[model samples]
Target: MLNSAYLCGMQKYKVHGALTAVGMIYGVNYSIAKEVMPHYIQPFGFTLLRVGAATFLFWCYHFIHGGESIDIKKNLPRLLLCAVLGVSANQLFFLAGLNLTSPINAALIMTVTPVLVLLSSALLLKERVTAKKALGIGLGLSGAVLLVLQQGESTAQGGMLGDILIFLNASSYGLYLVLVRPLMQRYKAATIVKWIFLFGFFMVLPFGWEEFSSTSWQTIPPLIWLAIIYVVVFTTFVAYMLNAWTLRYVNSSVVGIYIYLQPIFASFTAVLLQQDQLTPQKLLFSLLIFSGVYLVSRK
Candidate 1:
């Protein structure tokens, strides 16, 4: 019995570690990705770049590891749906929104994803939202809101339309988490993501091809190119892989709740980079966010 408990604890620790890694990757990506879009590349063009490169990487990873092939006949339809929700629509709206909004606004708005996931899980997966989980989500959200607001008027940099698109992105992602949870149980993460990105590539090609073709690729600086690579490799490929793998060990709600950590990671990065200073107010908000994460993560 003691051995079994120890194994279970270690498994949970690994799952949380993966989720935290994803949070850090995505937290940094908000600024890195935002810096490249709408100037060097339009949102759709950037989406194409991100999805296309990620699709290639996922397939290459699958081949290198000898991952099993998916059942196209039975799973293709579901994979297509996931492509729409998880990849194409999700990425499109996010980049577009980020182009129109400030990075802080984008990160803060994304914190609402856990609430959407909690509600979706109850309605679709029929998963019960215990009172503890609900409270945790509420506290996390409050902290995120306070943090964003305290940043002063600059928080609304992108305006109402951008904010609305960010909300839509969050909604799509939350639903994708619930829907994709079952697929994680049935297939290897690489097999599923590779197929999803393949479908997503075709989906975004129509909207992005013209923008992609028109870009003056020669004018883009090397640093911006590096940012693009980071978005494609770390945020799109590695983060997605980690999120999908973690879902196999925990419920979708637990996966969603980890998003609350993103803003905290983002803030800490700013402090480390000397872009922002740490203050008591920021510390209080961090406490609230961490407390919420703890409550929801309780076994």
Candidate 2:
């Protein structure tokens, strides 16, 4: 017999911890992953390693505590679509973009995801929208423009093309967030996790195979090996699992707000390490995006 207050307390802790952990991982991942690409491995190859390893881990988790089977007839098609947008396209564009662009830019661009999801909900789910949410979306998109325009000003060196790809990646993932919601009500996160990675595994293999094959493992340093493991295990595997766990305790709006912290972690860490430089232009645009996300994410 638990009281409502106690349960509420526990949920708040769980929700906050989960969202913070997720933000830190994504924020740090941008830099860590950047270290590995072009130098040790290409973008597609690195993505292959990430999705492949994650897929295997998900299946292993399923084996230990697998739940009832998913409904194949009605859900398989939906799952496939989710795989394409959520896992395959999302991972592909992101890695490709990150390889070409600076990590700070990538992190800042990701802040728009909530705005994208909100708009999609309004259009696709026919959810009612208010003025605040609309302004938030506008501000969020506008901030991205500000950041894009300031590309060369900061120490970040990626080209305009990279930023464009990352924007596309964010768009794909935002759509995934919208589409996966209904399916989430129908299935356990564990069950869906396995399928999403498996489908993504196949989708990425062809594109990644050549680059993955060309890479020579012998040349990679121990530090890079550790980074690879981090991407495979922590960023891809644990992050996703934690996100699913956190969703059980908090609403999606709360989850969206946590995303705002990612750029903070990413930019601070990158600047501290001297891997990236901070500029006034970035700060100005970051303010716009953060304010936008805040407005959009507010109830």
Top model number, lDDT: 1
Worst 10 residues of 2 by lDDT: 1-10
- Candidate 2 regions exceeding 4 Å error are 1-7, 130-157, 247-254, 274-299
> lDDT of candidate 2 vs native?
0.76
Total backbone clashes of model 2?
Answer: 0
User: What lDDT would each prediction earn against the true structure?
Assistant: 0.86, 0.76
lDDT of 1 by residue, 65-103 (tens): 988866799887788889999998999899988889888
What residue pairs clash in candidate 1, if any at all? none
On a 0 to 100 scale, what is the lDDT of residue 118 in model 1? 87
lDDT, model 2, position 244: 63
Q: What TM-score does candidate 2 get on C-alpha atoms?
A: 0.83
Model 2, span 96-195: residue lDDT tens: 9999888867876777777777677668866566787677667766766566445444534566788888989988877876676666656777787788
